[model samples]
Target chain A: MLLNKIIREKINSKLMLTFTILSCLLVVLIFFGLYYKSSPLFTNNSIKDLLFSSEWFPLKGKFGLLPFISSTIWVTLISVIIAIPFSLLTAIYLTEYADKRFVRMINPLIDILAGLPSVIFGIWGVIMIVPFIKNHIAPALGISSGGYCLLAGGIVLAVMILPVIIHVVSEVFRAIPQDLKNASLSLGATQWQTIKYVVIRKSMPGIIAAIVLGLSRAFGETLAVLMVVGNVVKMPHSVFDPAYPLPALIANNYGEMLSIPLYDSALMFSALILFVIVLIFNVISRIILVRIERSLGIG
Target chain B: MDKRKIEESIFKILMRVATLSIVISLAVILISIIYKAIPVMNWGMISQTPQGGFYLGENGGVLNAILGSLYLATGATILALMLSFPIVFYINIYAKKGSWFVHTVRLCFDILWGIPSIVYGAFGFSIMILLGMRTSLFAGIIVIALVILPIIVRALDEVVRMIPQGLLDASYSLGATKTQTSVKIVTRQALPGLITAILIAFGRGIGDAAAVLFTTGYTDNVPTSLFDSAATLPLAIFFQLGSPVEAVQNRAFASALILTIIILSISILARYFSGKYNKFKV
Candidate 1:
């Protein structure tokens, strides 16, 4: 028994040490990748011009990324604006109003939706959303449409993120104590009133985390946004105007790296920016979510 | 009282409408893809590889892409499992639960999970350039494994965490070592969850295009070696859609149909297995 115990301890210690090293390696790889890949842009190009300037003519040695940055912010903001109200309502319906069978049915459906690929979303965006915008929304508003623009990308992103936001929000709502709702109901409050006052207020922190997560997803979304955003390197004047986000720019321009001197570096720098922003968002949301779960006193 | 009742009914209607929209959106996507893909999908499209001018709407199939995706996803899932299983097992068994080190590691994995797939592609591209390596099947496998590591680790961690503390104590009281308990007891308990995690990760890897965009350069030929450049279904659809030819565009829909069928089947199988496993749980 003693001999077996000592052998197990030895193996356990060795395996644990190895895994710890692997964890460290993951952090090193990400930081090193960003630093090493974007070095050319920092060394050769002026950081001020690369960030502040809006002109992005790679062949002419101009590598401005302001257009992509603003466009990313715009599309993400638009998507959040489009998704939040709908997600809130759906979450409320699921938690407060839906029957058990309905909840069970929709839960798996949501999982399947979540598992659907970004490419599938892109195809749907291209075939359905884009043409609908061009033929209906644009013409109604007296604007010429190419069927691919910020609006189309934003709408596609909104749909893709809806499942996530709904899932998170519903969980948060469900986490609120049953007694709270019963108390409100016993006081003559209606279902909506109880939910609006008790459920939504108590779950604010988790809902914020969910919104932040959705924003991060929208900001990082690639294939669907790339297909619909028109890949134009310009500041969009309106939702109907074509524009490029940072991910789309990196994806669309990476193939043409051989034609320009520092184009690859520029794209890498854009990717680094994306990585930093997404990492920050994820860390913030996770912290908030943990706090909320702790406060709920659930394991 | 009357005003409150009116407001409640109105809000209920709005909520129902919002909920219905979600179902409608999913239905529209599935229906439209099937409508367009069915006409172009056939045995020849599935069984044969692309011939000359496949992108130009000539006679050919996406066999190369299907096979390539299977190879890359399987390779990446296996590699990710090898890396993730040890890390997860260490955290759950070796380290003290709720310790600062374990928390930090979990946080790190969460951040890794959130990093954009495009960033992985860029990082992989740079690594390839620094090593003077061309895009190949191996590169895609590595990057996709990196992309899914957090997923597998977190998922398996959740499963391992569910192992009853009493069981571990029982094993220890029986004079069994920690390694024996972990390997014999914990692993047996986590087997079903581990399989589900692996399947979901494989699905994510197979469907991803961004992380493999630069790593796996497109080719119509099925890759026979790790170093060979290979095509994937997502990129295949992307390239096909880019062509102006009408027939080529239909092929893109057909490709999406095939990819969807693969993912849906995996999902259904996973659900079935998980259900079956639940029946056996202690």
Candidate 2:
């Protein structure tokens, strides 16, 4: 019986280890798979021209991704700029100032927002934000826009990522020992002073990691941004200008990629770019998060 | 001292405003969708498939998309569970504490969790091209399974990690092998979390649009087989909203309402069951 049990145990462990290794290898496979599919584009055009040039005409084989890349950057940057302050303040409020019952009430609301489908957000953007911008905000600012522009995409994305940022940042805040807050309080520091000097200082790395993760998420969002951001293939000089983000480009054009020469390859290349960028951001944030957890003795 | 007090009050108001804004946005989104959908939402909306000229504001419902999403999410959840259970079990039960392999696997999962679904869509499309396969429910299931695999594994791993080591030790002292102990003790302890994880993954799978957009070609009819094209609710909303007709746009809001209800209920169920089941855990 002992021998039989030992054999079974060995077999089970080996089987599970195999699955674990395979799962890890799957990520690498995705990278290589995307690269292989996009390799054809590299042969005909240099990476510099493909990424730098602004012209994009599939019929004549001119695929410049600068407009898409720039639009993605502008939209993501705008979202981060708008979202960081609001989310940070919200996190601070929930963690430091709010009562337990209040926080509990808000938590579920945040969960609902986070669980909401991106398509719903897209619809909400179309019906609400687009018209509000076109009819109200644009004219007030002495500018004219058709409602579908980079600003609309940024606003939609900011709302979408708010819950994510708040969740991470508040968790970090909660992880701080109560004794540390008490120590600051005992030093005659007001709540805001303690938060400004101690809580924010201690959680800076975590806050940054949360923002990076949020930015990564904003970069990859497709349908919502696709719906609001006018899919115009040009550089966006201002927030009210139309833009086509990288994920939107892939989502919009992949269905019709088969008719033109190397169209599939170009779209695949854009997907590859998104994949790499998200991977890098995720890795950077993971490193920071792990380090913070280790320093806090919670890992 | 007075200046510091004033500064504190000012910052407090700012934080309150920030929190209120987020809550207000959630309310706005929910209310707007509900308001727009109420007029169009009827028994027929959920009961029948699209008829001819349905996109042109003719009589029909999103029954095809509703059924397709159900079938797709269900299949993807099952597949993801199969794949995730083994990996999560290996990481928590079989691997040594702080093992390099465990660290690497966890890191990979974290990265996978962050990858955008659109990239997954493109990747799935490439896989289809390689296999010479057409867009079908099967392809969508495969792609969504990949999308949710990390979610299930990470959630399950978090629960499994919290299982008391003493429980496993006691089982081992009783001559229980690691396999026996894991299959019985660890799984039982993690059951609540596992269920919650599954529900969460299902919600994500069903609500997702980008990953399945290219993999599952939308159809007006409900798919009878895995090889048939499937129209998901998210895509239905997208396609319907794209129409310039008022009726078609209203249908999009109604579809969005249905999807929201499904997702919200799943999340609530996950939380409720997890709390109720936690009492059974030692």
Predictions in order: lDDT: 0.88, 0.93
Question: Candidate 2 lDDT, tens digit per residue, B1-282?
Answer: 699999999999999999999999999999999999998998888999999888889899999999999999999999999988889888887889888778889999999999999999999999999999999999999999999999999999999999888998999899888888888998899999999999999999999999999999899999999999999999999999989998998999999999999999999999998998999998
Please state the error at residue A44 of candidate 2 in Å. Answer: 1.2
Best by TM-score: 2
The TM-scores of chain A alone, one per candidate, are 0.94, 0.98
**What's the C-alpha lDDT at position B190 in model 1?**
89
> Candidate 2's residue-wise lDDT over A202-255, tens digit each?
999999999999999999999999999999998999999999999999988876
Best by lDDT, which number? 2
Could you give the interface RMSD of each candidate, to one decimal? 1.5, 0.8
Error of 1 at B45 (Å): 1.3
lDDT at B75, model 1: 98
Clashing pairs in 2: none
